[model samples]
Target: MSRTPDNWLLKVTGLTKIYGEPNENTLALTGPQFGSNICPETESIVACADINFELYPGEVLGIVGESGSGKSTVVKMLYFDIEKTYGEALLKPYANAGVNTLDESNQKKRYIRNHLMGMVYQNPRDGLNFNFTSGGNIAEKLIMAGNYHVGGIRERASELLVKTEVPVLRMDDRPSNFSGGMQQRVQISKAIANNPPLLFLDEVTTGLDVSVQAKVLDLIRELQHELGIAMIVVSHDLSVIRMLTDRTMVMKNGRIVESGLTDQILQDPQHAYSQLLVSSLL
Candidate 1:
């Protein structure tokens, strides 16, 4: 179910990120054509450039690339984890989509993050506070979204734990005490605590055991179906993209080489880099 231009949940245009001062030709000299993200003249890194996409409500979009390909940088910028060099991201639920979220004040960005979006990082430690118990983490998210009643917070936390297949009994335990897989499940529980419309998942199952990764992916699929949440999943693994995404963007050297429906990309990858990635799956 694709959305029309009139009803995109999130629209991003000219999304770019750079690590150092770059000259006008930085973007022009870098990317797939050069097989690098570095500018030879300025020695600056163009993390990603001219990224444009629209994610519809309940849609799952995949960004696939190898390490240092800037796939993670794109979402980090959108989620405000890292400041973008330049970009405009508009969310339908915020300011009627008239505002560029990247330019918003920090307080406003926090509000948007708490109420409109959620992010699950590759490392559970990045997303969860080790000092806080599982339930405490969820409570923090709920409180930020304005759910103040203690009883309500507890109940909601328990419910989220159950929804994410984490035992409610572990609610009082800190994530540091949980297994890697369990900690990730708890992270997912906390991420969706507010019922945000959009979620960003960065290599969510990258380090897990094969069986555990499958389980976590299944949990994510279940939650997306149950909550109708739109997601942007970033990963180097094409298999993960195949199982989870409706559409895919194949990226290399800080630029997207091709994009299309997931099935089509897998069956008929067009670009040389994309073909190499797809062949790796076989």
Candidate 2:
């Protein structure tokens, strides 16, 4: 995914994650590890291995595969939710002189997560502050991004809610009262609170009814177009990928099997797994 950088917001290469310790016979492992801390019964679980991709500003990249394909793991690593065992990712803005995010200080990583990146998990609970008011939820992010004025925060929060198609009057209510679709919208509103440069959506519409899923997906498309945010969307459903992504990557058993323009890959998948996925969709 790394060539010449022309307005690319992110460049990731060799991003990897393996649960548990390396196999006893493996020669080496990357990154820090306490070999003794691993559970004796656990063998290493390679969730995602050697993932490489890039995102141009405002482009939507989709990762699609059946469950346990390591698609979610890839996004989690980029979001810093899962520690990568090896590999480096570069966010162009912060990667001056080759600053690899996998090696960045925790403080800097936190700053990037709070200010430059936003995420919408399939479950609203993962992205939303369940206890906080809808408006307050967005304000939490704004506050972290260094916005201090209450009035400005409230205004922005309200704007985002309306933009995401949530009723402004419900801003004071907690997300616990919202329906599945409403909760996802509220989470979407909170994610874009700071107008972040990069956004991550992991199965954003996985469990919703068809109608509700369409609404959530539409809102995502609208937000991406309006905000011009580079985004990585991870979903097991190819339909979801087709609906929103510019480029798509197919994964299986912790590795990328195919990647290309969304339509091309969907219509003429090269990898055996990708072909099977497309056939199943039909």
> Once model 1 is optimally superposed onto the true structure by TM-score, how far is the C-alpha of residue 202 displaced, in angstroms?
0.2
Residues 1-282 of candidate 1 have per-residue lDDT tens digits of 567769999999999999999998999999998999999999999999999999999999999999989999999999999999998999999999999999999999999999999999999999999999999999999999999999999999999999988899989999999888999999999899999999999999998999999999999999999999999999999999999999999899899999999999999999999999999999
The CA lDDT at 186 in model 2 is 90
Clashing pairs in 2: none
Worst 10-residue lDDT window for candidate 1 reads 1-10
**Highest-lDDT candidate:** 1
Worst 10-residue stretch by lDDT in candidate 2?
30-39
Every candidate's lDDT: 0.96, 0.84
Q: TM-score of predicted model 2?
A: 0.91
- In terms of TM-score, how similar is model 1 to the real structure? 0.99
The positional error of residue 50 in candidate 2, measured at the CA in angstroms, is: 0.8
RMSD of 1: 0.7
